[model samples]
Target chain A: MGHIVEKVQEYLERIERSSINAYIHVDRERVLKEAENLEKNEKLKKRPLYGKVIAVKSNINVKGYLVSCASKTLENYISPYDATVIKRIKSQGGLIIGMTNMDEFACGSSGETSYYGPTKNPRAEDRIPGGSSSGSAAAVSAHLCDMALGSDTGGSIRNPASHCGVVGFKPSYGVVSRQGLCDLAMSFDQIGPLTGSARDALLLTNIIKGRDFSDSTTVDTPEFKVWDEEEMKNFKIGVIKEFMEVSDERIRERVERAIEVFRDLNWEVVELSYRYIDLALPTYYLINYVEFFSATRRYDGRRYGYPIEEVCGEEVLRRIMIGRHISKKEYSGKYYKRALQARRMMKREMLKLFKDVDAIVSPTVPKLPHKIGEKLTPMEMYAYDVLTVPANLCGMCAGVVRCGEINGIPVGLQIMGKPFEDEKVLNIMIGFEENF
Target chain B: MVDREKVEREAEEIVKRFSQILEKYTFEEAEEYYILEIKNVLREDEEPSVDPSFREEVLKIAPKTRDGYIVVEKSRWE
Candidate 1:
């Protein structure tokens, strides 16, 4: 317990000295108190995540802490109550270190859009940490915390994890409760864990997942299965051709190396393609705009910190305006409805592919993360999500594992499985990690 | 007199622009698409229990309050 407390204190000091701007708020007193309490209580020692320090993305509420979502709209807003995941983590003796930064309102793909300042990639100081779960990924990679909770909407968790070289897992939508997460796009959002390893991610997922009355979207999910190395050879893995086509040659090479490892293990590697793969980004953004607009209606300047339109960053404003335009009564059927239809098409395609394979694999991001402060158009930034949005669009489970490195920067191999097959997807990730 | 032809032409233009955006995602041509079965989960009809201090707690964070109620700027004519 004493050693764990010392480690927690050391992390606090490291966070203080960190230049990445990974954390938006650090409640040092609260962190120390929790650590001291854990040291005193022998009963807490039996908990699975006992004395583990966990950083939470700013979008998820931690009672009495500022859940700014890395935006001025909620910059000073103290959460009124603990989110369900926060309650679960605390119960398991996980120490809540602080709230980490993210893209403002989780609207952007790069951490650079954060109002607090972009979270620099710890792996490459000059490169951007892919976002909107940027800070959580950066913190985990930098070892400022043992694990972090991040929300994924269109690759937010996995994207940053890929850039920072850590494990990020987005459980199937509705598997983990979304009650306290500030919605970026409710239909696409899932609160997930980013950790240093695949097994740690599974441990956090086990604690945070289950049916929650507070979030009716939650369903009765099966418990996470322990990894069985013997079962690894029996599964078929699909490599999406479209994903490979869009990725940089270096990234593709790294991902192919990972696939080759699986092949050597006697797992059959199949080439698959989806005709609508190119449409995933547009479809994802369209739904994101509409849902984010609907969700942010509560920020009317009275109940929250400020009117969102006036205080939010540019990317957020762009989405809201686009949402407003698309959701107009006369335009809804043409844009919003069509996007939903496209979503359905994507889900169907993924379902068909899953019938022939245990899981699909791809590069987590099509290219290496751009240099921090790079001037990229919104569309260019959106392109970063091309390979990762399919999992969110189809409401399937996805996990990213550090596969290989290029130019000294780490790349991730993405594994996606059918909805509610989170355990299988994670087990496959663990197997890959072990093999690599 | 209402310009019927002009109005129809403008409406057509708007539809054309919207269609172009949808086309970018291949949604304009998608014929077969799945619609999820959305069933509303209704709670039992009963008087809801409330905490006695709930209102006070909510008001604590409201930007403006008057006479124990949230206050807002007038946005419409009576």
Candidate 2:
């Protein structure tokens, strides 16, 4: 009991003196009150997440806390209710530490888009924390919280996890509920965890994943195959040829080093190619623009804090305008519809490739994190998500683990598995952690 | 309107590149495939259950509220 109280106080003090800008809100009074109550209750002490401090990304709803989405449009608004995941976490006695900063509306790949300020990578102080889920990953990396909740729309979770050198898992789409999460692209949005280790991610995932009456997209949890040392020897791993072609040589060397870990264990490693991989970025962005524009229409200065169009950052405005153009009655079939077709093709291509391999391995990001406030074109920024978005496009489970370092900066190796094969992906990550 | 024009120019460049890449593959004229197969989950028809306090919490977050309801300006047509 004393241990939990001491830990919470320690984190709160560190947060006060820190300049990473990882957290946007931390109520010292409420956090201590919750910790004290947990100390008093013997029954709560038996729960799995008892007294574990969790940092939540600002976009997710936590009752009475700000769910600002890192945008001025909802800056002053407090969450009216708990998200389904938050409810589940609380039921297991997990303490909500505070809401962390993020790329405003989860729209940018770099952490610099937040209205609050950019989150500096704790691991590499001058570099950007790869984002959308920037603060969640940085908080875990900095030891400000035990574990954190992050949402992945298109590589948001995995990208930052790579840059910040932590474990990030995007569960198979629809396995986790999205009832109270603010939408980025409804079809692709998934709430996941960024943690210090793979096992912690698995523990938190099992707690929050199941059928939810409120989120119609929720599905029954799938049965996971427990791993045996001898049985794992037979697993076949694939390295995507297209992903490697675009990666910086330094990142590729780190990926190859990770592949060597699998080979040394008598696991088969092969190269597989999917032709439509080049189309992933355009397809992903076209759909996201349309859906994000649709979702922002509700913020018209009536119900929410202010009008999004008037208050959002540049990237958010660009997506809205692009979406508006594509959605015109005459432009429909030319852009959005073709992107949907390309999406279907990408999914089919992946399903076919998965039949030959248990999982695919690659560098999580093609390049290392750049310095904060670096000048980059929109297309250049979009390239950071190229390797990670394919997993989301195909509705597959993917996770990132710190494999090695390049120039003293951490590099992540991404493991992607077939849909509903989240356990296998985590098992591969765990195996990598043990051996490397 | 100037911002819109710049946005349009940027959109054109992006669209042109995307179209070129998409043209490399031949797509079938089939219905778009959805990832999940489940249809909408319908609730049983019964008298609605409401939490009265929820309304108050919702109204509290609104930019404008009056007399226990959210307030909005009249539309341009009105």
Candidate 3:
């Protein structure tokens, strides 16, 4: 009967009518009750996220909710406790709307690999909504929620955010606690926001970030600052030559057009070449395969859901198998160790490059989203992460904001900032969003 | 069912792709790099009290469970 409840009801109705398959679970009664309580709870209204509804990526635990990770491996698994991020959100009065669909165990790039089925792009109905944070991005794009939480292990957040025409951010590693996330890779995974605007992303980031005792990887970084209009100008944007060349022509044009906004503001746009960038995918996937294999060994079916190898989708199985092979003692140095060295080199390269430029700019994804259910080879799917993986590899902050559309489907311009300079990446995004 | 042979073939191709990169680049021996300096934070020795309801929740999700205990297969060691 209250306005808050009425508004939430409208969203729930839209979700019910939506064919996007963005959410895997929505406890309608619980959500409405929370909204109703928000109307009466005066103290809660004073909190930062009082009226905001959040959709969580299935990999992150929400107490008493099914945390399926979009895989049959834990299809019926209920979370016994809230993840640290969820605790923070609740403490700030953020209402969790539902669990969103994703690439099974956050393994796929195209969102179609979920056991529940792919999340349809709300912006481009027939095409894939990029993943493994598929539903979080789609939910925001479709107006199903004010914002969503997504786990980014090599662009899971920004990839889908770009495809769905929303803002998705991957905070610098160790900036946000990864405590309750069913991690894809411990070394790479970060939980971040998918929202309609850069400011909203910042608001969510501020709430979720900081040190937590439960997650030893967490760091108490300096608070992020909101940039003034004048502060956004006179910065250099480094356009990686490889990122541009690897993109489709139309996407390249859109990205070029997006860069002109910075140029118009008198920001110098420089071309920076990193030849080894071509190896980004293989290096990322090689590390990913090994870590994912190690992480999934816990789901042996006796304690949780089905054994992962028995019920997981093809992509998950592929990563597991490759991870197993590379982790073998005989092959360790040849593959996984080599990839680790490459990662270190890439990290050093990023540090050197950032010395000259404030942020690196590129198209968020190399190509536009392919049609849903279109069969892409494993290599082809992995190639989608080429531009975004470097940030994770080097532990840099990155964000995607829609700059323009290619044939009515949105194209995102990715801005990556130095590690812990998340505010700078966000401010640049905010600057572009304001000027665009 | 997972096709082991197909996965192996795919794995070989992927490994070959990266192997070429590794072969092309040479690096001096360097220590492993982690994002942060991690240390084992020790706490005061104490027994962790288990909550009964929380224990029940854990048992509930187990595919196989006995009275208040998760039932896992016995090891094959002699």
All candidates' TM-scores? 0.92, 0.96, 0.96
Using lDDT as the yardstick, the better of models 2 and 3 is 3
lDDT of 1 by residue, B35-75 (tens): 22335645568888665665776677778898999888776
lDDT of 1: 0.86
TM match of model 1 to true structure:
0.92
lDDT of 3 by residue, A301-417 (tens): 888899899898777888898898889999988888888888888888878988989999999999999999787878898889999999999889999999889777989999999
TM-scores computed on chain B for all candidates = 0.46, 0.63, 0.69
**What lDDT does candidate 1 reach at residue A40?**
87
Look at candidate 2 and give me any clashing residue pairs. none
Candidate with maximal lDDT: 3
DockQ of predicted candidate 1: 0.16
Q: Which model, 1 or 2, shows the larger lDDT? A: 2
* Model 3 misplaced regions, further than 4 Å: B1-4, B29-33, B42-52, B76-78
Q: What is the DockQ of each candidate?
A: 0.16, 0.50, 0.54
Q: What ranking of all candidate models by DockQ puts the best one first?
A: 3, 2, 1
Model 3: how many Å of interface RMSD? 1.9
Q: Candidate 2: which stretches are off by over 4 Å?
A: A222-226, B1-8, B29-33, B44-52, B76-78
State residue A307's C-alpha deviation in candidate 2, in Å: 0.6
